[model samples]
Target: MLNHSAGIRPQTRQRVLDAITELGYRPNQAARALVTSRSQVIGVLVATRAAAYGVQKMVYEIEDAAGDAGYRVAIATCLSDDVSVRDAVDRLVAQAVEALVVVGPQAGVFNRLTAHPLAIPFVMVASDRHDDLSVSFDQVEGARIATRHLIELGHTRILHLAGPVGWVEADARMRGYLAELADHGLAPRPVIRCEWTADSGYRAACEVLGTTDVTAVFCSNDQTALGLLHALHESGRRVPQDVSVIGFDDVPDSAHYRPPLTTIRQDFAVAGQRAVGMLLAQLRAAPPPPADPVRPRLVVRDSTAPPG
Candidate 1:
């Protein structure tokens, strides 16, 4: 026993494997897989840049759910392209993944996807358009809330900064802003179109400055609002006191701004969990399934006040 200390312990599993191999027996593969009918792996395709916080939160929630269900997650990056998304799907399929959760798909994906038949079950995250197996935040209600807050503060000459015209989410928010204003018989204020960026917001803000009688602006997103804040400061316009600013998407750090931002909040994590649940039910062909549409709400803060 003392001399045996220099030797390695006998390898038992290898010996068993060797015996099985010699006997042409598929012990592990046959026994484990035959009973389970599952590969225990799930594929995830994140379809946006790595920097988006909302997308990151969704991924975390999906990961938590997969772990609890005894499933291993395999992640792939689509990085925003129809070709890349399809390619990512191919890659995941090659890994023997049983299902997929595709995140941050653009509204156009549904149209593109209709052309191809999916080999594995798929669940789309943050799709603005409604789908049988989807969960989305209430963009329209949130934007309406943002606009109403300004209107209540005596902002009659309010403007709307909209995101790209073609995207479904942007259009939804715009609709809310329009409806909120129309209810009060307020004439339509000029709307600025821009990308979802702080710099674009700054440019749009400058355009708003050229026109007189503007009392407030409802930005389509937090980043654009941040840029508007900078532009207003540089142009000697005070927020709330001169021109109130409201934004959508209550991202972290909005509260720490010089004049804390008031915006709408979307529960991305909840949406992600709900989307996966719906997808799973569909995958299993559950009978008499029920999937209630998820709705978006709003959060208000200190960004708007009565206009002088």
Candidate 2:
């Protein structure tokens, strides 16, 4: 009666439900799993350092979607090293998770995952469509949109403040920036590599201001852009006046920046929902659909304009 199996009379079912409520009985998920071989749990793997706003938003969305579908989510946080990733995977597998979702921005995490394939269905949340089980916001296209906006504003010498070298999103954004520049017949400038932090962005901006002559700059992420904006302000340069600046990941705080930054907005909710749906489908033995990268849109603000 509790399982709601068919063929029970309504009166008997009501009586059993009433009795259960009077007894305050709760179903034991562990005992049920033992009987039915269904853990009804989805595992999520994320890197500790990669827990940015976008990643956290996606994870929240995934959890909500899974709950709506009558499943629980088990999250495992790991460091950005091979050993940590392997251990995380082992931990989730030991939990009898029916499926897995990988949600870190590190390339090394994916490399380790590829080297050690899983026995169960899994989906990777990333910007690259490297496999059928991957879902992402198109990082490359987002960069292109940001760069093209600056180019159309008549800024010819645009500097790219790239993210850490081994990060996947950073590399994709850099590729997009370079590709857009090439399409406009502009020579690519040397990229300044920085960690995905405001401090790193601040230092990189200082370097750029000291050594390079540019009309604009594109940062790999919103935090990096925030640092750059601070550096430019301290250096007595005006945004979109002395130099235009743009960033990626239209984070919640980007709009609150001093200059209200222009940025690329990724649909993290859509990405999360699609990733969960894909994993569910895979678990049901359905054929995987073609992997399509989610497109990002640009949000214009006070930070970018025609180079003065």
Candidate 3:
């Protein structure tokens, strides 16, 4: 093919490409980064998996998007709060990440960001408890959908398995749940506070099972729903036949759960994509319009039905 140079030598071009592949030689992103000062890496700072569901999902999605966009994802977790987040950002900076995306920093994290000088662009995945983000999900609306679904099914004594006491987003979601109930002219039923864990859900469900005959339960997250399902079954209550259950986050295992849980599906992957897109726009010194809030869709399966 190299010898056959006529007709623009298509075979020769293929041979050259094959040779490049065989040699394991590739263009250096670093060279382009150094020349343009755009590292082509998106940094993702996230809380531990136990602390934040959305962020965990978002981080993985951001990595996927970055890969598709021809960039890399540099991540740090267990940055429990703002101080740790700042430190993590410094670390990613060392790795030459051109932009940043943070998830679930404690209070003052967003506030502090305003005063901090950033050498590169950054996007916060969720911080509305303190301040509205550059962009994110329509959390309130999602809760509204969850609540409305219950009400439409004639569930008036709807119960809420609220998230841990100080999470702002949790508070917002709870409020939406309550507001939606009140709007239907129904009194707010019992709310069981639980940590974001399957065990917590189990304990909370046991508590609820002991007294209230809640026709329906809205778990704060999927893990809790898993726990609740167990407690309900043990108490001689059949799902959908006795009490309907619903959950948020639609985690990967939700669909595979016993009886196949019904949950609110938020495409954190899409959210992650938006975060990196915003960061890239910032890195390029280009205007990044606000990312449209992601909509949550209720994925109904074996868990929910008319109260029997």
Candidate 4:
């Protein structure tokens, strides 16, 4: 009766339930798992360096969705290196997680998992699409949207402030910017690489301002844009007048920047829900649905305008 198993009369079950409620009885999950052989746990692996706003939002959404489905989520953090990735996986597997979600942005995590496959179902949340199970927003398209917006505003000498070299998101955004420029027959400028930080962006902007004479800059992320805006302000260059700026990832604080930023908004919540749904379908042996990447939209703000 306590387990809600069938074959128990309603009156007897009600009496037992009333007594249990009066006694404040609780069931032990460990013992239940032993008898039922279902851990009802989903494991998530996130790289310590990749825990940005978007990734954090996705993790929270995944946890909420899993709870609604009667499953608990266990999260583990690891470095991007192979050894750390392996150790994190071991810890999660020890918890008897039925499924896994990999949120690390580095290529090493994928390489390690490919070399040694897990028996359980797993999904990767990445910027680039893979042949295996994965979910991502259309990074390339998002960049194109940002660049196209600048081009449509009549800015031709557009520069790109790229993210760290070799990062999947950085590479994708760069590709999108290049492709859009090529489509427009505009010559590409040299990319200034920087880490995904305001300080890096500030330094890069300070250095590049001496030689580069571009009318607009497309930043890899909003934080980079914020730094660039600060640098431009300090240098007495007005935004959307001397140089227009656009950025990716319409983070919450972007709108509050000195001059509100124009950016691309990624639907992290949708991606999280879809990832969890895919894993549940795999566990049930059901046919996995189409693996379409999430679409991103452009958000126009005060930071971009026609070249002066």
Best by TM-score: 4
Global lDDT of each candidate: 0.76, 0.90, 0.78, 0.88
Question: Taking the tens digit of each residue's C-alpha lDDT, what string does model 1 give over 1-308?
Answer: 21235355468555755787798964353355457776767888877553456777888888887777766688888756679778887888877778888775356765555567787777776677566655666678888888888888788888888987666568888998999889988876767898888999999888768776888889998888899999999999898788888887778978877689988877877876776676567667864234444555556666678896
- With a 3 Å backbone cut-off (N, CA, C), the pairs that clash in candidate 3 are none
**Lowest lDDT 10-residue stretch of candidate 1:** 1-10
lDDT of 4 by residue, 214-243 (tens): 999999999899899999999999998999
Q: Which residue segments of model 3 deviate by more than 4 Å?
A: 1-36, 49-53, 105-108, 129-133
Per-candidate TM-scores read: 0.82, 0.94, 0.84, 0.95
Choose 1 or 3, whichever is better by TM-score: 3
lDDT of 2: 0.90
Tens-digit lDDT track for model 2 on 235-274? Answer: 9999979989999989999999989999999999988998
- Candidate 4: list runs displaced more than 4 Å: 7-25
TM-score of 3: 0.84
**Model 1 whole-model lDDT (C-alpha atoms):** 0.76
Q: Between the candidate structures 2 and 3, which one is better when assessed by TM-score?
A: 2
Residue 139 local lDDT, model 1: 79
Model 2 TM-score on a 0 to 1 scale: 0.94
